[model samples]
Target: MKMTRFLATGVSVALVLAIPNIVTAKPEVQGQVDFFGGDGVLRSAEFDARIDNSGAAEGRMIFIDPSAAAESDPDGPGEAVAGAQGLLIDADFDCLVVTNNRAVMSGVIVDSNTPERIGRRILVTVEDNGRGRRSPPRRLTWGIYPNQARNWTPTDGELGFDPGAGTSWLASDAEREDDVPVPSNRSEAVSCDSFPPGSHTLVDIGRDDGNIRVRP
Candidate 1:
C-alpha cells in the first residue's frame, strides 16, 4: 500500500512537470504606424497590424505616391497634388519578433492595388522612440535637412536615422507647408526579412509617428 501511494504521487508530479514543457508559450506582436516615405515610390504610408502566434495577421497598408510636380494647385479640381496616387495592400502577418523597444513584423501581401503584386512578401520594423526629437526640422530637404544627419549619408540599404538609437523625426510646419511627404530622412530599410522571420532583429523604418506594441 505504501509503495502504491508513492508511485501515484510520483506520476502526478511527472505529469505536472511535463505540462509546462508541452505547452509552449506563444508570443504576440501587434501595432500600427502612419508615416512618410523618404525614397522609393512611396510618398507616405500607413500600416495597421494585429497578428497572433497562430500565424494569422490582420492588417492593411496604404501608401501615397506623388509623381507629379509640387505645387499642383491646392484649389485644382483634380488631386491637390497632380499625378499623385495611393496604393493599398492587405497584409497577412505570420511572423513577428520583438526586442527591447522595437518590433519586426513579416507578412504577405494578400491584396494590393497593383494586381501583379498580390501574394508578394512584405516585412517592416517599428521602434517607439519615446515622443520624438525636441527640436524638429525647420525645413525638410530630400538629402539631409541638418536635423540629425549623423554626419553620414545613408547607404543604399541603411536606415535614415542611427540604427543604435535616435529619436524619430516629426514634420515641422516648414516641411508640411512645403508639401513634402511625411518621411524626409532615410531612417529605415525597406524590409526586415533579411533575417529569418521572427528573429530578434530590430530594423526601424523611419515612421512619421504612431504607436506599436509587441507582447513577445
Candidate 2:
C-alpha cells in the first residue's frame, strides 16, 4: 500500500509538471523580411521580432525603414543648420502584449563627424506583426513640421522654418517655406555585394554589416 501511494503521488507530480507545457504549447515563432528604403539609397531599417519568453532562443523577425531630416542655420551670428530628424531604433521589447516593456529609442541625428549636434523629434510607431494580428502600420507623419515660417533676421528675430506637422506646403501666403524631407542619415548596415561607392559607411551589428550616415 505504501509503495502504491508513493507511485500515485509521483504520477500526480509528473502530470502537474507537464500541465504547463500542455496548456501553453510551445508557440511556433515565425519571422520574415520586409523591405524599407528609397529609390537608390537606404534611409532606415528595423527588424521584427516575436518570442515566448524574455530570453527565448526562438522568435520571429520583422523589419522596416523609418527616416526623416531637419534643417538648422549657420553657426555664430548665422543660423543653426537643423540637425537630422527621424527615429533611431536602439532596442524595443514590450513584456506584455500591449503593456509593460522596454523601448530603447533614440530619434535624432548624431553627427558622425561631430557627435555634438543631435536633432530631436517624436516619430515612429510600434506595430503588431505577428501571429494573426493585423492593424494599421501606424503612420506618424502628422505634426512633423513647423507651424509658421521662422523669419531669419539678424536683429533679434526668429529666422527659420515654422515648427508644425506635415507641411508638404507651407501655411497660406507663407514665404521661404522649404521643409523638404531629405534622407541624409543612412542605415548603419548594408550588403557588400549590393553597396556602391561613396554610399553610406557600413557598421556591423552582430554578424550583419549595415550602413551609417552622418546626421546633417
TM-scores of the models, in the order given: 0.40, 0.27
Deviation in angstroms for 192 in model 2?
36
**Candidate 2, which ten residues in sequence have the lowest lDDT sum?**
138-147
Best by TM-score: 1
Tens-digit lDDT string for candidate 1 (22-55) = 5754444444444344444334445555544465
Per-residue error (Å), model 1, residue 48: 4.9
Error of 2 at 109 (Å): 9.8
Ten consecutive residues with minimal summed lDDT in candidate 1?
138-147
Supply every candidate's count of residue pairs whose N, Cα or C atoms clash at under 3 angstroms: 5, 34
RMSD of 1: 17.1
**lDDT scores of the candidates, listed in order:** 0.48, 0.30
Model 1 whole-model lDDT (C-alpha atoms)? 0.48
lDDT of 2: 0.30
Clashing pairs in 1: 36-183, 160-186, 160-187, 160-188, 161-187
